[model samples]
Target: MSQFSLSNDNDDSGRLKIHLNSCYLHVKVTRPYIIITMGDQIYQTSISEYPDGRWNEGFEFSVSYHAQLFDTIQLDVYDSYMILPDRHVGRAEIRLIQLQDMPATFTSFYEVWDKKLSTGASSHAVRKTTMATNVGALQATISYRFLHIGDPQQQQQQLQQHDLDRQPMEDDLIFRKHLQQNRDTADILFHKYEEGSHANMDQLHLGTQGHTESRTTSSSSANTMLGSLGSWFGKGTASTSLGHPTDPTTDDLPTDILNDIDSSLKTYPLLDTLGSWTVSKETNQILRAIGKLLAAFGQGFELSNLQMLSGFAVVERFYQELPREQRTWDVVRDLSEIQVASHLWRYSMASYGWKGLNFIGKGNGYLSDAIRHHSDSKSVMEHLSLPPDDLLAYEFRNSGAFRPSYFVAHDPSTHSIVLSIRGTMVRPKLIAYCNRHSIGALYIVGHSLGAATASLLTIMLLDYMDELQKGQSLPFTLQCFGYAPACCVSLDLAEKYKDHIQSIVFADDVVSKLCYGTMMDLKQMIIAGAEAAQNLGISQFLWTGAAGKEKWKSAFEQVAECRQRCIDSMENPRLYVAGKVYQFWLDPTPKNPTRIVVERTSPKRVSSELILKTSIIMDHLPTNFDIAFRRATESMMTEPREQQDGVLDQEDESRTAEQELKHTSKRGGTDGSPMIDEQYTR
Candidate 1:
């Protein structure tokens, strides 16, 4: 008999007493018995009667304390068929940890599952057949207790044995510490090589040699320290190195590998752009450039400061034509339309300040103030000039980090529900929440990140409109106004939803042009420019500084050539700005004052080339959009009715004429136009 046998042995560490109460099964059996297993020990209960299957019998086992704490007990019920093999009815398992905390006896009904029935089925399918596959429920009582074996002397000896058991673990931890230190040192050296900060080839060679020597020294030192510990434990010496025993050096690299690297450098135009500097320098630059290219391919591209400044200078000339008076124009008087861009701007701004102010509480005291005082009311009410009692219900949901926060307000003035979504906050989770509360007209307004969310929500709502309007008498209408919104939908979707959405993009706002295809084009442009510079043996850095004007000019020419090629090669099925886009740009005609022009343009037309400008970030701000909207509205209001209607038709001719005149005049014009069409071919 094993030492764990239940024979009332005084030396037993502990005992597990289990009571077999009763079991219920779907299928009836003649003879049923349960096999209980804990660690290597197994116990079988006597065969119970059919129909009810109640034994009400108890069994006890002598188990060590470690086994009682750690092991899981499994109960398998089977039917005896005499000639045939025993049929597995069901099975159930319980860990000792579940009953360790119980004061006395722990009694519960454990559901037994038919393992054969559940095989090869998904979790969902298993859930659907849970009732069918549940062979029976076993109601059992479990009791576990520890027995005092000896006096304090024996307990003290056991404690010492526990310490002896932990000695190997402590030794392993020390080894790991030394190993980590070596790895850290190696990582630092590798990092230095990657950064190309090494002074010269001699230093690089010495550093590599020193690194190998240090790694070997550390490995020997660690082994020496652990040698005595290994002997005490009667074990072999532990492996010191985590990886390969010998580190491969540059001299060890195959000639074929070196040739492959050289070939790769030449074949890739971007790699060639870095030129043959030090091996380390070339490798570093190539890696950095490749990383940037891959990132752009994944997350969209960003233009260099030089490119932005160049684009801004070209676009700024248009803004300079705005009359001095109009440049300082502000919204002093209220607009006639309540749902105008200015109102939307105010609503969008108020959404940002929703959490801070107390006046705009759940009860809406400030809302009442707006209704009562009209213009005299201070706070957000002064900015939001809605009609009396027009504000109905409002809700601000900003719970999760990833979830987008939105301010929903009911405005009866225009029979619409206004949803003002806040722009990207710190660590924001991009999630869309769309549900129709009212059958009223829905107007979605957002700037930047929020604008993208609003656009997507509009599409989602449109797709599920039928289900949403199942019980409603009136159909819901969604109109989205996105200010400087990111490209969120494909060109096809944008065209499809043109009538329902409007994207108001400020001049040269970079966010508006950020899309997958445009970014890929940007990557292509960089590579092409690099190739051109490489061919001429000119450094690409010359374009950013005044080290050599002639060199910079040549480099810029190559970049321009690449830019034009990239622009011409743009393709389709790419993410485009959602909705009918209205681009507000400064139009400065020669010999005329600068005027703000709001033109209706296609998403494809706007995203053709990246408008690199210093004001790209600033242009996306709500305050800037507010000022631009006010000025554009003022410009439209002041213009003649006939001119207002014919603006779009005459825009092409005017633009063409301006381009031709700029080309014919000085290549470097006095008015600082820069002759973009002739020089850069934008």
Candidate 2:
């Protein structure tokens, strides 16, 4: 029998089998799982808890004789964590043919490999450490026993376990490679941004060849949250910088925070049972109606104060009006502390997309200078040609672990991508209140820009916990649902925290597709900008009239030129809708008036054609999405079958004359196309 042995070597060890061609075998870690390919066979391990130091007992698995002929083995060790990206700890290569003949048993075959940061670097420099040292090492011992082809009993046993072995199927291989590439690309881009920012900071410090000084100078203590000598990961006193990893600080966490987070991570299959039938029809109808009110509430945020509920009062009244048995959810908080920092830009001279708002730090709110150090994001206002007043007030005072990207704003320069200044002020108060009084899960919901802000805050909180807890997973559970959200994240960040985000999209929602200009062709970008300018009205400005008209005209021209320049430079901005997406579509055919469909889609599948018939403004509103959502959910009650194509075959449609006509070869689907639409062309 051929005996192939694999072992952890250490708590973080992994093995890779090389082919005769000298190509290094590949293996990747996705949190609790590890995927490895040996010879032509791929093996996947069962999900297990993160390992502690040294489980030295070697592992045994079946391998073919041809695999044994392969002469090399590469072992890579990684430190996998939930919140942070996995770190490569160590790697080693062993030439098995040189050790001894494969058939012989060898116990003395061993090697110690030092952990490395990069391929050429010999020093074991950790993320924060400047000097190299023996930070970590791995000692591996491997043995192989070759078996004869005539060992029928051994072959039979191996055959029995074949089903348990997870060979990397075609789809899995493609998807895993894609995810890896996306991650790598994101890392490269972020590092580039960091490098560029550092260069700019140096120039600013040097006064541009001694010709200029900094724009402003303040005490270093003014930016207290910004890194100083004592910041985490910064060089400073070890006692203050490195807290005990086992116990997180209690100052920032709720007493039951750990328990809450742990419980939320556990599976809840009951959620799968939710449908119109699960609750009273009346209750579903009430919720459907409330969806419209909620949309109105979100839209009103730009014009109204946080204290005003707008349509929410109507929603609360409707909930109270529901029959006792039909009340599915008890009204907990009508408008909790879910404050929205409204964003507005001058789309045209005649009118703004949304009206004027106060600029932060000038009789409005405070904006920090910390984000300014990340030079890549400095062009936010210039790219859009937006006035300073248009900038959101949110500022992260501390050095962030993550580089800013599409999640907050369009430009990759120094911009606040997280909470608005108002949100920055209100968030802590809300979080503190939740920790003190939260009896159950914290539910956050937002629409449009509010959705983007909500998503940002959720991650921000997680990072905060990661710091206080020293990598311990937070205890309490929090969930966010964003409706009609614009593109606000890179694919890597999306995949990194896929479990925590969900978005609702209406058919062809224009708002959801906003940030792709950086990814789209220049023609598309120009068209988008023109459309925004036209629809929002460039003449809305007071200076557009005869008084100061010449100056305003020149300013508008410059804005257009700057916009085109920005688009030219943005070759392939990292942007995408992160996490699960629920897409809704309305039936286009007249005969199927009531037919609406909702399909669960990945970020890659979101398309602009779904709502192609509606105006851009109408396509993006939550009010329209709510109507379609209700209709789709109602249709699900009678029709439960999914079509060969993705669209659900609703019972009402299946029972109709239109369905019969569409099923025939002569007349199938609109424009004689297939019933289901084409996938988004990424």
- For every model in order, what is the number of clashing pairs? 5, 32
Model 1 Cα shift for residue 289 (angstroms)? 19
Q: Model 2: per-residue lDDT, tens digit, 81-162?
A: 7788766544444533344344233334223234333212221112125334433333334444444444554444444534
Q: List, residue by residue over 1-682, the lDDT tens digit for candidate 1.
A: 1222223333322557778788888788788888876644567877876655687777765454334443457778888888999888877666564665564456788887765332111122223545455778888876654423444433444344455446758854654454345434422211101001111111122123332112235545445335323422333233212222222321233334344334323154555555334233335445554553353243212345554444334333322332222111121232352136556766666654322232223224433322221112122343465542333222222221222344444554565667777532210000111122344466788878778877887875565455444445776667888888888886778889987788878766778887645654555445434333443333423343454545545545555655565555443124678888877655433432234456667777665555544466656655455545655666667766654443322344446556554544454533223222222211
lDDT of each: 0.50, 0.35
Q: What TM-score should be assigned to candidate 2? A: 0.28
Give the Å error, residue 370, model 2: 40
Which number leads on lDDT? 1
User: In candidate 1, which residue pairs get closer than 3 Å at backbone N, Cα or C atoms, i.e. clash?
Assistant: 308-612, 321-593, 321-594, 322-594, 402-429
- Model 1: residue 277 alpha-carbon error in angstroms: 42
Residue 332 lDDT (model 2):
12
